[model samples]
Target: MKRLLIFYFLFFPVFLLSEKRDVYAISDGKGNIKLFWLTSPKNYPSGGWRIEEEKTNKVIEKQLYCGREEFLNALKEEEKGLAKNFIKIFKDDDKEKKGKKFLIVLEAMTNWNFAQAIGIGYEIKDVPKGKVRYKIIGLDESGKKVGPHFLSDFLDSSVETLPPDAPENLKAEIILREVKLSWSQPKEKGVIPSVFFNVERDGKVLNLNPIIPSGEDSSFLDKEPPSLMEVNYFVYGVDVFGRKSIIKKISIYVPDLKGMVPPENFTAEEKSGKIILRWKKVENSSGYIIERSNLSNSLYEILTPKGIQPDMEYYEDSNLQGGSVYYYRIHSYGRDGKIGPPSLVAFAQAKNQTPPPKPKNLKAKVGRTMVQLMWDRVDFPVAGYRIERKAEGKEKWDRLNEKLTPEPNYNDITGLYTQGKFKYRVIAVAYDEKESLPSEEVEVELLDTVSPNPPRITNIESFDGVVKIYFEPSPPEEDVFNFLIVRGVSEEDPGLVIGEPLSKEKREFEDKFVKIGQRYWYRVVAIDKKGNRSDLSSSRDINV
Candidate 1:
């Protein structure tokens, strides 16, 4: 009885383990393997199962999973509970196929939970490659039982190049003004490792760059897309080797925008010679358009340039008539070029303090004894014209007309004898004494003078055989066509003409005809463009 009792205790557990069947091995995608099977109803053990290599007769990985929760926790997060729904509807025909879903033995496998599935996996570093065979042994309160063996076809353990395959089942979920995309990875052999994807919308790339999906589940969220009414999305899978697969496309409709808000807090004020308008910035607005009318309900005309940028909140409308009642309205534009409703109409009466517009097309005519200046009349009412003049190349402008002149033309009699250039400007003065900006300046040349001021000998140094003379040309040097160098022995005697006339710019002359050790007198006279010569310059004596 003692021998029989000991034998019965060990052999009874082996007899129960013999009932467990359908044991199989699966690769966990990592360098790991897993084992699963179903045991007879009400026969599953209290302790978990142990996976063993059938060929080597060695235990590879062991785990204690006595319940469904413990079985799922033993697998990777992505693989956990993946087959639960399929297993719930599993039938005997599911085990007949070559690539089939097998049932795993769970701790809940009472008579009612007979079909409950469970799985456990670990790193396969200890197992050899090729046709891997594994068996599951049920661990009970007694010793573990060596269950029946199942085989899996050859699994290539060597590293390989995995080509990226087309993404599957692309779905876009529309949120307000945005979209969220999710998809499944390609099937087994074509699945890419560490793969990323590029997102395109309506044939245009949307993402700043390509991106890898977060977590093992493939998904991408588009926070801020374009402003289109409908969007078509395309996702392209690309592997680390830059291989691109066919695109996964989906179309979705987004909620239409309510349009940009009209400009707010709009106000206008009369400033120096212009109407200054200001407003608060509008959200999602590309720019603002301003309009104005002389009277309320009158035809309003666009006052701002098209596409005027809204970045600057203030705009100045210049040249507006003073003492005028102006009605103004403004509207904001969206990026799509749709205009929003106009803001509340704002009105302001421009103060009656502005001067008339500046005179245009100013004209100056030189006369024998005076200069006559004329300009286009200002269209509006003006008190009179104010004339200003400045010498050529000079910045200081002196008023030529001491008092306002009723005529648009002015006669400059004071500078009639000055043989140089002078610039003239015209400004209109309002009845209120406000002065308009200066007109485009007009330059006048006073070449009516018949003769230029005589040239003066600046230096009369004598060379070994020549008298080198230097002289400064007279005022209105541009009018001096040439110079006549006169030679004589005394100031009382009129000097004889020297060599050919010297040009106004060529003031220095080398009198090579002069003899050394002789006293000679030199004088110079400037000739004007009219061929008139001036009185002789002061004589200078030089020993040559």
Candidate 2:
């Protein structure tokens, strides 16, 4: 026999009967049943079995077999022979037609045995779709001394073969007002066999009936949350034929709070002439109220106005006395105006108005598109430096930096098209946000003073004692005024001027005063009318 044959009906009574959990049966097609009931009795006449046809009100007799393993194993030869005859007597009566259906009952009576017990069972058939009702007859042996009789609860039997698999991965979470549960559907071959699910809490049925999931949903929320206690939940999938799957279970704890929790991470600092206070916010609060005290322990007063939002975490006290230490404490209130416990005291010193010394040795360099400025760094604990600029003749200096300049050097790269003399000044700002006197002004003139591009020295030749030079002039004559030719004994020496600056119109110059076997190096520079000088050209060498 297969394992399913061995185990499928091994515990069928528990699933089919309303009054007994251990009694079970399996039937052959010809109306013969191999029923198994795990029961025993010491005496013969004291214990028996009863069956009832609920629809016709007919009572039938069922023989109680001594199915104890030891008793069956130890049967003598004659006893075994007698059991064969008893099996014939125990067969169903001919009145029970094979093809007809009837509401039937199976009742067990171990009441007279030393161990008193009684079980009554019922089931709805055609296709079983209901719960199993179970009840113990009695607890004492005297209570079991009754005669055989039919149990009234039996009604039918079912032949359903398949039940859904258990639900997977059950989860539970406790939120503000509800306990949420989620689970995956059972695995099936083609389509879902589930008709609904039954939910339970601590073994008590929660939904009045099986809960039908909305289109393809797998989650449910329990709005009627349990009290402050650990609660267990169970979800069981029930198929269309009322076959139930194994249960998915989870447990969660619900917390009970008496009042609101206090704020956390409170801190205070003096920044930009104001006392800034901040702390982590608490949930479900109306707003936070800040208190200030001049003395360390007394004279605290509320500093915030009413009706502030609950999410605000920072407050600024701009009316603080300069150079004085202010102690602060904060508390959150609910919508009902009930205040929570006050936070730990925090203190900060208001900044003074005295400023640090001004920066010195300011310098400016003007470029085509930008001007770079540098100055001595301040050693005092100042906030930062402020840079301002204006036209040379303008009285008011417009602020150049959007915020305080944190470094000693800054590049004025914002406005470049306005050309002329520009004057700049920098001031040191103290922690109290007081600006010091402006440093000495630095001016830069922005005019077109670029020199013309240089010419190339193409080649040089020396014949006899005279050196002749050839060159190429690239820039227009209107931009270049002249070129200066200088000679050097070696590459590193800046020799005397070979001649006055050469005219732009002249591209080459001949050095006639050269001795035989002497070597010389020569370079030229182009000078424009604005007095701006270009870089030296490529060097040429001559040996005569």
lDDT of each: 0.64, 0.60
Alpha carbon deviation, residue 461, candidate 1 (Å): 99
Give per-residue CA lDDT, model 1, range 87-110, as digits (tens): 332333444531322222221211
Clashing pairs in 2: 18-133, 111-144, 125-157, 517-544
- Residues forming the 10-long window of minimal summed lDDT in candidate 1: 1-10
Lowest-sum lDDT 10-residue window in model 2: 101-110
TM-score of each: 0.26, 0.38
Give model 2 RMSD, 1 decimal.
Answer: 18.5
lDDT of 2 by residue, 1-544 (tens): 0111112132222222112323333222232222223322222223344443434434332323223333334444544333333323223344542111111111121111101111222222232333222221212233342442322332123323335566677888754446788886555543224546778986777776455444334677787766457888989876433457778788887543112345789899999878899898877677778888988789788887573567988888888655578999887765556566678999999985456789999999887778899999876667789999999788999988888888898999835344678899999887657677899999888855666677778898998788888776656757778888777888887676777788878978888888889899887777887666777777888777
**How far off is residue 389 in model 2, in Å?**
3.7
How does model 1 score by TM-score?
Answer: 0.26
Winner by TM-score:
2
Q: Check candidate 1 and list the clashing pairs.
A: 32-124, 516-544
